[model samples]
Target: MGRRRTVHKKLPAHMHRKGNSYYFVQMVDGRRSWVPLGNDLAIARLKWAELTNIGDAEVEDITFAVAVARYRRDALPAKAAKTQEEYDRALDRLLAVFGKMPLDLIIPQYVRKYLDERKAKVAGNREKAVLSTVFNHAREWGYTKAANPCAGVKGNTETGRLRYIEDQELLAVLDHACRPLRDAMEIAYYTGQRPSDVLKLKRTDIREGTLFFRQKKTGTALRFAIDGPLFDVLLRITTDPIQIPAGAVRSLYLIQNEEGQQLGYRALNYRFNKACKAAGIPDFQFRDIRGKAGTDTEDVTGLGHAQRLLGHKNRKMTEHYIKERLGYRVAPTPKLLIKQKKRA
Candidate 1:
């Protein structure tokens, strides 16, 4: 004979029935605070959910706006300037939509809806990243203990940056680019380094025949050989007689504004964009030059040999750049199948 089945009854959290009334167990000051929740199990369940989700000692009843404000005030200043700026842009959109929403209620589904409404993929992704950072900071600062809403919601497919600078476009843009942007673009092109890393270049970073520095994002120590074009740009900037500020040191940076100081990433981008527009080559950007280097290097030396040029520790990341330029279609054709008849 089969063994007798043992059964366990399911109960709504913190709920118990007595006669026609239902009571909920609410924790208060290490004591049970029995709250009346009426007789209907559905009503009791709703009441239980409401009470249980409320903030505990570690978590606070903080709104998303207040939490975000705290993060903006206390944490963002300690981050890299580039990172702060990007997060600031992302926050601009988030605050407009979820400023008053409770931090604990903003789940993955809510964030997905926010992402869908964004027209640009990159914009949506940036906002999602910023939100995650906000929640992480909130948890540490005792704002809320809810899981980050941005989790499990994947970012949109990024539109690959395909604009590469050719010889003619480079010449035209260089002819019109301001002094700061000219040096910035040329360095990025010759060395295949990020504009952020290139803009942070100090005059002291050059040694022997290579430019050596720790990459800002990855912390990878990179040493790129100074090609002929890079040497030419270096020579011009090194020799340029710019008026140094009252307290600023001369020759401190590889690229500088009119006042001899390190160029900022934001300032470089604004000026570079204007230069591209003026040169009738508005499509080209500073990053496109970096991509051009990757494409050119991959063609000449193959993917493995081009690894050092981009300063990536992993070859997979280096290959991503090369693959973008290859223009290879990813969609495969479906295999045709012939129908077969079966007989008994």
Candidate 2:
């Protein structure tokens, strides 16, 4: 019913060339749907057969690119902004390797090979996780009938961060921090909250002599009594004179820039890194402050106190988090044993 293409006349029925690329044309719901079969004629022919073979009609055939597009449309919107950014980065790497491959053809061996070849082992693990999710969604969408290929694959080994900021290191870094950075650091250190939680704090979060925190990552709600160092930090934030930039209203967030805008992640990271560089403490990160709080709390009080401060669900997790920072000390000398032996 359509005009025969004069150019690429040698192309098979239902196949057409547009620019440099080939397409497989099918009528779906009475409208022509053009599925991309890529640019190479030989590979396009192979993909065309995969799509149109009578024996394979029962199983939906689509490339990983198509499936990823569908996934980005349907799934990525539901994730948090930070998580979406992480997945987007992973997806870019995954698409380069498997984009043209048929979704059902992506086997476990291929997944393993990709992981082995990737130079960034830790980042490869994250990309593998994103690929696994794509396969899962592909199955649900009927694009593939096979089980997810990434299920049994073991990712590269990764160790937890073990750096601890000493008291002098903290003081040095604090000396170089700006007003907003100082406030953010003290809040993070005293409350033992994540950087995200610290930035999200507002005047409304404090009520009736207690500061409340609802962790963004874990949804763990914590309440800290307003006392001691935490109390001093909060008082400073409240009593300090804030210089608002022209045409910018005061921010609802506790941490704000000179412009009176809520401190964003990029700004916060830049300022913290600059301060660290100035202090000559390049190894220290803003996150290590939380660990310091936990370690110091455990030393002064006990493990339970540390667990509560860090908002960990259990003491075991708290122990693992603080163990590296709890540098070894000689066990108390056996004075009681000596006394018992003397009496005997």
Q: Candidate 1, TM-score vs. the true structure?
A: 0.69
The TM-score that candidate 2 achieves is: 0.78
TM-score of each: 0.69, 0.78
Across residues 1-344, which tens digit of lDDT does each residue of candidate 1 receive? 42333431234445666678878766699888889988854456456555655333234457776666566556776777678777766876787888778778889998899888889878898889888888888778777678888879989888777675677888888899877888888888778888888877887898898888688888889776777877788888777646666886665778788777788877988888888898888777778887888877787778776678788788988888777776543667667586668786
Lowest-scoring 10 consecutive residues by lDDT in candidate 1?
2-11
Local accuracy of candidate 2 as per-residue lDDT tens digits, 217-298: 9889999999999899888888883687678788778898888878988889999999999999899988999999999888
C-alpha lDDT (0 to 100) for residue 221 of candidate 1: 91
True-vs-predicted CA distance for residue 120, candidate 2, Å: 1.5
lDDT of candidate model 1 versus the reference: 0.76
Question: What lDDT does model 2 reach?
Answer: 0.85
Best by TM-score: 2
